[model samples]
Target chain A: MNEHTPTPTEALPGAGNGLPSYLEQSPAVRERFAQLQQRKVILEVRDLQKRYKSLQGETEALRNINFQVHRREFVCVIGPSGCGKSTLIRILAGLEKHTAGDVLLDGQPVTGPGRDRGMVFQGYSLFPWLTVKRNVMFGPLMNGHSRDSAEREARLWLDMVNLGKFADAYPHQLSGGMRQRVAIARALVNEPRILLMDEPFGALDAQTRAKMQRHLLKIWRNLDITVLFITHDLDEAIYLADRILVLKANPGEVQEVIEVPVPRPRSPEQFSTPEFRATKARLEALIHPPEAQGEEEAEGEDALPEKIIRFTNVGDNVE
Target chain B: MNIRILLTYLSRPSRYRGAVFTLGAFLLPVLLWCAVSYVPFIWHPMVKVENPGGVDYFTPGMLVDRSEFQDQMKEMRQAGKPLPVGVRANPIYLPAPHEVARALYTAFTTAPEQRDAPWLHQSLWHSIQVIFWGFVLSSVVGVPLGVLCGTYVTLSRLSEPFVEFFRYLPAPAFGALAVAVLGIYDGPKIAIIFIGTFFQQVLVIANTTRKLDTTILEAARTLGTRGWRLITHVVVPGILPDLYRDQRILLGWAWTYLIVAELIGTSSGITWFITQQARYQHFENVYAAIIIIGVIGFGSDLLFERIGRRLFPWDRTQERKSA
Candidate 1:
């Protein structure tokens, strides 16, 4: 990974790495390294909780959640349905209010929906009435960017998502996959510090989903923006994440935080690699534990072998 | 004019059914009216007269001419005798289709006074003017207030009972009071149309505004849109297509109230012209005026459908089903 670091000529200004170029003199590199050691924490969530009260009764949605996302990190939150994953991302998007907690983005409290965080949803919630170009340019135009510049930015993102020809097309005219690409471009045009996705590919077909996962990873790497993705798909989390936050349901609580040691620029074939399988099996046990039954545990590590086999079987169906 | 070509067009084309159906829909009522008027030709009197005192014995097969029946009735009136009963009425009571068409042509082209007073087109123009102003005023007042009510639940609740209560109170019931407050010329007529449409428009437009997709609005809000900007940029555009449909329906309703409104305190609209012709027993002219109104209303509806389709081509919800 270090060998792939950008050279001095190739280094972008204000790139995610706050460190000065390592191609400089050794002494300068050391000084810059010392300065860069304090990497900026892009988002901080402390003791977040959500509660819903209806006429029938009160239900806790999330309880005592805490996490920090550093700059340029891709963090995926995986859990079962009703595990408050959507609620958590919605709150972070400033689309929902937290019951009690502090969510700080660049140390400023999130009061309501703002331009700092851009979100893409599983439903592909592009404004159907607007053209693809207009939908992508909406954020910039509303925030007072001149029309020309906003459209320019829109075109850039449209090209990035490979939907440049669909600028004038309506959402209904696009396929499900193309619409999701427009959604991604629409959110990215806002140029927010963090991208919040709530099961963004959950509605897509299997092939489209696989392609989108790859597309999203490529975009995420190029943009170098922090992302907090919420998905119930364990395979998706393992495939495209720096760290996976596994949540347990019944008033969702953070069950574990597993760091993937599988190297960067992950390919589709890596799903079968032993390291990937091992990581997935550990997550599977936490989600559906065989140890829950004492009698079943008498076989000693019985859960691990069966879970690995099931994971490999699921993996084989990916393509 | 090309019968063979039309037949070929109808028979050979895949999508000409709608054209054929539209032609039938227009021609059916006229054909029915023509058929009904020929009852005299098909007459074999059903009622037999049993001359009680041997006065001019009457029989069944004798054709009862309508003019002779009218003459007898006139003679009876002059001679102070009670009018005969059990006699079949004249089929002239329902004017034939050609009679109405002739009367329509005369009303527009012949009557000297038609130029100044309530000529067919003049009366129609007056009715359209009243309806247009009334509809515009209602829309001007209704759409924004409805948007406000939709955005704020407090305003919606406050106006809910008032709108609900007034909607059931018939618009015509206020005609006299409207005359008193707004006067006889055009004010009361316009007011009547306004009263008829405004309350319903408020409720409809408000519901439409409220029903805009929440996710789309949320997406807009996340993009730093808020307050008036939110309404202008997202909420307004989001609801425009639906509101256009609602307006089309409400416009038809406004046309329905035109006759009711014009019937009060003014001899200026198509209904007034019909009433004037009815006074002189000119049934043909009355029928002609009614047909004109119907044609105009139908034309207005076609116009609205065209405008709606042009403005919001994305509104495939209703049009696509028929298409």
Candidate 2:
């Protein structure tokens, strides 16, 4: 892993000084993620589905949720709330059971969780008794690493996430942003082939969330690790994903696949650019599709229907 | 906290020193008692204990010798200047504040051999023995049962009534039952401690189990962790800081039971020693024994706090940093 290098075509020279896109991320950090899509297929989910019985009737959380996460592909699933976006992410992480079909990781059906994958939950699920460093070391230590090796890995990951100074601090001592950073370091310390994040930064403030988004993007580019990120935020999906999967409600299934054509080392300032705005508007309309003139409102939301506002070249909605 | 804000934060800390200041204010009053009672005066020192009608009548004064004044009054002589109205009369009472301090200092520094063996036994070993035995009994029964109450649904349901029932039984009532069944001896003292401490420790273990964070436990099982690993690594650590705090409280509870045990148990303990002294013409010894008991109790609580700090350093840091 240490001997690998990025070719100029894969590098983002737009970053000042014509550096590799991954180098524009945390410098001196090792590339621990698997190679790009060319390496190997690590996880394959076939016809995966999960159903929940509601008071109204049986509600399908997911149906025919099929996707294969190639080695080192950053995939973001963006959808409406009842679209089973989060459930599919949990199933892929082995944190939730699939009612139909099966999940294969590293060529074996995922019977239960293994060290090969790590999950970052939406809420702060940190253990209160552990210091930041010890929390990071939890997975490796539990897997029976020697104390020294665990400490080394813990320190490396904490520094990678810019939390080296907080290793000895308890989770409560940290702000929401800092704690999520620790959670990321903790998840990545085990060097899982795929890191599953379920809206990990959803609780952060807007400014902090933006900072974390960029940090995550850097981490993704540097490590080239496959990420199964689930979020309802369309901008976040457009911002970070190489490809975004959109899901629809009522027997949830992927409705669209939006491939991001932008190069890496992208900045938040680009969000106002013409290309970015068009993509954002398209996603916004899809997630909140507008109703026909006389059609009834979306189920349970009598006030409004799914959004389908049209837009002009300047990115202003025309309808 | 910044140095500039230190004083702002510190003002509140110092305001809470009311307890320390109050204890200091009483020090001189206690010391006065250790002196005036021993010096000769025209009348009894203070608090005359009279056995005149076989039922004792006590008369308190600014300067009275309890036993001698009581003897003189029973013989139809004056005790001293008449005690003021609203003054409480108890033979063990010392009117002078300084005397109590002297008594306290004397009780602590006096050699064990210098005091009669029975007095020493009653003042020290008796209470210590009771508290020790009580803690042993509680741990022996409470912890395992608490674990069962927490981990297993059937055991929890079955044990709930017993735990709740026993927790409400007054310590003094338990002491009376012990006295009736075991008679005055080591058995009654042990029973007193056991009765006082057992229910609390059981609750500690049971509550810790019942409240083990469900999310963490779920995370553990999802990680392929099961059996002891699931219980020890996930469940135990998840509940440890809470358990340690409860353990510290348990140690203090043991000391509290000691005072209750000594007060009622017919065996040798500081409470028993003080009671016996109060009956005799020994007001000084009673005050002295009480001060010693306070010190012992405070010291035991402190010892456990120190032990908790050492064993659970994470909790200490969490407390100090407010994290």
Q: Score every model by TM-score.
A: 0.81, 0.70
For model 2, what is the alpha-carbon lDDT of residue B177? 82
Per-residue lDDT of B190-210 in model 1, one digit per residue for the tens? Answer: 998999999999999999999
Per-residue lDDT of B39 in model 2: 45
The lowest-lDDT stretch of 10 consecutive residues in candidate 2 chain B is B81-90
lDDT of 2 by residue, A1-319 (tens): 1112445543333334432232332221123222344568877888888987879988888988777778778888888777878788778777678889989988888876766787787887777778999888887788888999999999998998998988887777678998888878877877788988889888988999999999998888789577989888877887888667778887788776655544555788767654456556556656765554244343455556457564546655456
Local distance difference test scores for all models: 0.79, 0.69
**Model 2's TM-score against the true structure:** 0.70
Pairs that clash in candidate 1: none
- Per-candidate interface DockQ score: 0.31, 0.22
The parts of candidate 2 lying over 4 Å away from their true place are A1-39, A51-64, A80-85, A248-255, A292-319, B1-96, B106-117, B144-162, B165-188, B209-226, B259-266, B281-291, B306-313, B316-323
Tell me the tens digit of each residue's lDDT in model 1 across A1-319: 1112334443332223343321222454345434433668899888899999978698889998888788888899998677889999999989889999899999999999988898888886888788999999999999999999999999999999999988987787788999989988988898999999988898889999999999999999899688999987878998998778888887988877656655567899988765566567666766766556566455645444544335465447765
Worst 10 residues of 1 chain A by lDDT: A13-22
